[model samples]
Target chain A: AAGVIQSPRHLIKEKRETATLKCYPIPRHDTVYWYQQGPGQDPQFLISFYEKMQSDKGSIPDRFSAQQFSDYHSELNMSSLELGDSALYFCASANQGLYNEQFFGPGTRLTVL
Target chain B: DQQVKQNSPSLSVQEGRISILNCDYTNSMFDYFLWYKKYPAEGPTFLISISSIKDKNEDGRFTVFLNKSAKHLSLHIVPSQPGDSAVYFCAATVYNQGGKLIFGQGTELSVKP
Candidate 1:
C-alpha cells in the first residue's frame, strides 16, 4: 500500500528565513493533517484539510500557513522561521467515510539556527 | 493542559514476554483511539486501535483495550521481540471533529533479547 509522502526529509535553516514543506497523501485519501513533534514531546496538531478545504487548526504559529491542492497533496509554508520551530514535521492522511485511521508519512526534521 | 498523556517515560521488557503500554486522556469527548510504533528518524506506523464503543480489539500479537469510564487505553504486545523495541504513541480523536489526532507523549519500550 502506498503511504503518505513528505518532501525534504531533513532541513537546516537560519532564523528569519522561509521554508516550505510538502506532503503527498496516500492515493485516494481525502484528508490531510500536519503535526509537529518537539524533542521528547508528543506530536502537536498544526492544521488539517479535507478535500482542499481548511478543516481545522491547532497550535500552528501565525507565521505558518498551509493549503491542500486539488491533487490532494498539502504544503506547509513557514515564514520568518525561528529557532523554536525546530522539530519533526509529519503529515498524515485518512479517508473520511472509511472511519478514522490516519496513515502518517516519514517526517521532515527541521533544524533552525 | 495535556489532554492525552503517557505517564511512563520508558519501559524495559524481556523478549518473549508481554509488553504493556498505558495512556490516559482527560478528554471524554474523544471517541476513536489508535496506537502507533515509531523508530528513530521515521514516522509513526499504525499498530492497533480500539474505538470508544469497543472494549477490546485484537490483531495477531497486538491488542488494544479501551475503558471509556476511565478515559484510559492500553496496548498489549504478546511474546515481544527485540525488533519491537521502539517508541509507542497513543492518540485519540473525536469522531465529528475534523479527524485531527491528539497524541500522548510517547513511551519508549525496550524489548531485550
Candidate 2:
C-alpha cells in the first residue's frame, strides 16, 4: 500500500531537551506536511515542505521546525521541548496534483516530562 | 479561530444503522471537504471527499453531503459495523494549494454490535 512511514512510534523526553521525529514520504510524492494533535483537539498544521523548501507554516511556535531533504525524508525538530509540547505528531505525503487526498503516517506520540 | 468545527464530541450507533457525522466551517473560501477515520494509536485514513461544485459524493456505503449555503457538510455511513468504530475528523481545504487541510476537532463514533 502507498503510505507514509514514521520512525519511533513513541518517544519520551524531558523538558528542556530536544527531540527529533522522522518521516519518509511515499515514493514520488513531493509535498510533505506535519501536524500536531493534542488531547481532545484537532490536528493542527505545523508546517509544510515542498521541493525541499519551506512553503507554509502554521501557527506553531518557532521552537518547532521541519525540514525535507533530497531523499524526500522529512524531520521535525523541537528545540527546548516543553511540557505542553507533548502530543501526537503526524507526517503526511501528497502528490501536488492529488491535493485532495493525503496519505498519513501512523504518527509518533511524544511525551515530555 | 477554528475554521472547521465538529460540534458533537461522541456518537453511539447500533450495528446496521445509519450514522451521521456533521461538520461546520467558518471559511467561505474553502472549496474542498474530506472525512477521515482514525483508530486508536494510528494516523487517520482518508474516508470520503466532496468539492464545492457538487453537493454530494458517494463511495460504497459512505457518502458526503455538502451544503454550501450553510457552510456545512455531513458524512453518512450506512449499515455501520463494530469495525467502523473510530474517531472521525472533518477537514477542509482553501484555494487547493498542495492540500493544506484545516481540520475540526474529531467526533468519536462507537458502533455497537
Candidate 3:
C-alpha cells in the first residue's frame, strides 16, 4: 500500500538558483521515473532509472540532472533555473522488467521566479 | 511533436450516466497504454491499462477499449459518480521505451448530480 514519496511538496526558487528534489520509491520497486506537468499541459517524461542506473531520458533540460542512489532513492537536481521551469514534478515507481503499474507520488510543485 | 493526444479538454455527465473519454496516439510501436486519474493537488492514480495484445480491459465500473488499427483508445466510466470527477490522463509506452510513459493532454470530467 506504500506509494512513491517526494520531498519538499512545494518549492520556490529565483532565476539562476538551484534546487534538488528527492524521491523515495515504494519498497521493492526497482524503477523510478520523473515527469513534469506545466499548467494546462500534459505530464512530460523527464527521465527514468532502473536498478540504480539511468535507463531513459526525455525532454529534460541540460541544466537538470538526476540519479538514483544505492538505496534506490532518486534525486533530481536543477541548476540555473528559469521561470519556464515552474511546474508540478512527479516521481513514480514500478517493478522493473515485470512491467507493473507505476505508482506516482503526491508531486512537488516548483515555482521559479 | 505531440505523439499522444486527447482532443477533448473537458466533459460533463450527469451522475448515474456514462462518461466516455477518448485518446489517440501516432506511435505504432507503443505496446502498452494506461489511464490515470488525478485530483487538483494530487498525483495521478493508475486506473486501468491494456496491452497491445488485447483490445479491451475492464475493472469494476471502468472499461478501456483499444483499437490498434486506429492507434486509439477510449475509457468508459459507467454510472458516473461525483467522486469520479477529475482529470484523466492517457499514457503509452513503446515496447523499448524502458518505463518512460508518453502522456496525452488530459481530459477533465465533471459528474454532476
Candidate 4:
C-alpha cells in the first residue's frame, strides 16, 4: 500500500500567523508534490520536489514556500497567513516511472481565523 | 486559465446503477489521464487511469475511457454503492512532465441505497 503520511490532520491559526505543515512520502518514492485545495474549488499545484531539489512551482503567492529534506520528508510553510489561506493541503508521492501512480495522504485542513 | 473542466457539480445515482463522470481538457499535450476519489476529510485516492495509447482501460468495476482526439476522458463505475459517495476529480498529465498532474473541479457523487 502506497501511503503518504501528513501531520496535523486539523489546524487553526490566526491571521498574520505562520503555519507549517509536514509530509512524509512513501518509502522508495523519489518525487513529492504539494497542493492547495480551496473551498468549493479544485486542488491547485503548489510545488514539486525531486531528488532533494525543487523542480517546479505553480503560480502561488511568494508567502508560500516548501522544502524537501534528505530523508525525503517535505514541509510547506506559509508566512503571514490570510483568511483566504484556509484550505486543505494534500501531499502526493510517486516513484521513478513514466507511468508511475501517485498516491495521496489524508489532507491537512487549515482554518485561518 | 482553467485547463481542465468538469461541468457537473454533483451527481446522484441509485445503488447498483452505473455512474459516469466526465472530464475535458483544453491542453492537447495531456496524454495521461487519471481519476481520483475523495471521501470527506480525506485526500484524493487514485481510482483508475488511461494512457493516450489506448481508448479504454478497465480494472474490475472501474473503467476509464480516453479520447485523445476530443481531448476528453470519462470514468465509469459499475454497480455504484453507497460507499462510492464522494467527490471525484479528473486529472491529466503531460507526457514526460515529471508526473505533474493538473486537476479539474471535482464532481460530488451520491449513491442512494
Candidate 5:
C-alpha cells in the first residue's frame, strides 16, 4: 500500500533562514498532521488539516505555517529558523472516520546550524 | 503540561516471554487511543488501537487494553521475539476533531533471545 511521502528526507539550514517541507499523504486520505520530535524528546503535535481546510492547531510556533492544497497534499513553511528548530519532522495521514488509524511517513530530519 | 505519559523508559524481556508497555493520560476528552511501534530512522507504524467504548482490542500477538476510569492503557506482546526490540509509543485523539494525535513519551522494549 502507498504510504505518506515527505520531501527532503534530511535538511540543513542556518539561523534566520527559511525552509519549506512538503508532504504527500496516502492516496485518498483526507487528513494530514505534522509533528516534531526533538532530540531525546517525545513527538509534539504541530498542526493538522482536514480536506484542504485548517482544522486544529497545536504547539506550532508563530514562524511556522502550513496549508493543505486541493490535491490533498500539504506543506509546512518555516521562517526565521532557529537552531532549536532542529528535529525530526513527521507527516501522517488518515481517512476521517470514527476510529481512524494514522499512517506516518519516513520523516524529515532538520538540522539548523 | 504533559497530557500523555509512559512511565517506563525501557524494558528488557527474554525471548518467548511477554512484553507489557503502559501509558497514562490526563485528558478525559480523548476518545480514541492507539499504539505504534517505531524503529530507529523510521516513522511510527500502526500496531493496534482501542476506542473509548471498547476495553480490549487484539490483533495477532498484539493486544491493547484500555481503562477509561483510570485514564490508562497498555499494550501486550505475547511470545516476544528479538525482532520486537524497538520503541513503542501510545497516542490519543478526540474522534472527528481534526484527528491531531497527542503522543506519549514512548517506551523502549528490548527482547533478547
Candidate 6:
C-alpha cells in the first residue's frame, strides 16, 4: 500500500532563512495534517486541511503557514526560520470518516543553524 | 498543560511475554484514541484505536482498553516478539475537528529475545 510521502527527508537551514516542506498524501485521502516533534518531546499538532480548505489550526507559529493543493497534496512554508524550529516534521493523511485513522509519512528532519 | 501523557518512558519484555503500554488524558472532549508504533527516523504506524463509546478494541495480538471514567487507555501486545520493539505513542482527538491528533510523550518498548 502506498503511504504518505514527504520531500527532502533531511533539511538544513540557517537563521532568518526560508524553507518549504511538501507532502503527498495517500491516494484518495482527502484530509492532511502537519505536526512537529522536538527533541525529547511528543508530536505537536501544527495545522490541518480538509478538501483543500483550511479546516483547523493548532500551535503553529505565526511564521509558518500551510495549504492543501487541488491534487490533495500539501505544503508547509516557514519563513525567518529560527534555531528553535529544528525538529522532525511529519505529515499525516486520513480519509474523513467516523474513525479517521491517520497514516503518517516518514517525516522530514529539519536542522536550523 | 500537557493534555495527553505517557508516564512510562520505557519498558522491557522478554519474547512471548505480554507488553502493556499505558496512557492518560486530561481532556474530556477528546472522543477518539489511537495507538501508534514508531521506529527511529520513521513515521508512526497505526496500531489500534478505540472510540470513547467503547471500553475495548482488539486487533490480533494488540488490544486497546479504554476507561472513560478514569480517562485512561492501555495497549496490550500478547506474545511479544523482538520485532515489536519500538516507541509506542498514544494519541487522541476530538470528533469533527479535522482529525488533528494530540499525542502523548510516547513509551519505548523493548522486546528482547
Task: Give the top-scoring candidate (DockQ).
Answer: 6
Candidate 3's residue-wise lDDT over A54-97, tens digit each?
99999999999999999999999999999999999999999987
User: Relative to the true structure, how large is the alpha-carbon lDDT of every model?
Assistant: 0.93, 0.91, 0.93, 0.90, 0.92, 0.94
Per-residue error (Å), model 2, residue A78: 0.8
Q: What DockQ do you compute for every candidate structure? A: 0.78, 0.77, 0.76, 0.69, 0.76, 0.80
Calculate candidate 4's fnat.
0.58
C-alpha RMSD over true interface residues, each candidate: 1.0, 1.0, 1.1, 1.4, 1.2, 1.1
* TM-score for candidate 1, residues paired by index: 0.98
Off by over 4 Å in 1: none
DockQ of 6: 0.80
For residues B12-106, could you state the per-residue lDDT of candidate 3 as single tens digits? 99999999999999999888899999998789999998998899999999999999999889999998999999999999988977868889999
Give TM-scores of chain A for all candidates.
0.98, 0.97, 0.97, 0.95, 0.97, 0.98
CAPRI-style docking class of model 2 based on DockQ: medium
lDDT of 4 by residue, A1-113 (tens): 65899999999999999999999999988889999899888888888899888877886789988999999999999999999999999999987484347898899999999
**Per-model fnat list:** 0.70, 0.68, 0.66, 0.58, 0.72, 0.78
lDDT of 1 by residue, B6-100 (tens): 99989999999999999999988888899999998899999987788999999999999898888888999998999999999999998688889
Model 2 stretches with alpha carbons more than 4 Å out: none
Q: Write the per-residue lDDT of candidate 6 for residues A1-113, one digit (tens) a residue.
A: 99999998999999999999999999999999999999888899999898999888999999999999999999999999999999999999998783348999999999999
The candidate with the higher DockQ, 2 or 5, is 2
Model 4 agreement with the true structure over B5-105: per-residue lDDT tens digits: 99898999999999999998999877788899998788999988888789999999999888878888899999899999999999888777777789999
Kindly list the per-residue Cα lDDT of model 1 for residues A33-111, writing each as its tens digit.
9999998788999999998999999999999999999999999999999999999999999997643688999999999
Q: Which model, 5 or 6, shows the larger TM-score? A: 6
Q: What TM-score goes with each of the models?
A: 0.98, 0.97, 0.98, 0.96, 0.97, 0.98
Q: Which residue window of length 10 is worst by lDDT in model 3 chain B?
A: B93-102
Prediction RMSDs, each to the true structure: 0.9, 1.1, 0.9, 1.3, 1.1, 0.9
Candidate 1 vs candidate 5: which has greater lDDT? 1
Off by over 4 Å in 4: A98-100
Candidate 1 Cα RMSD (Å): 0.9
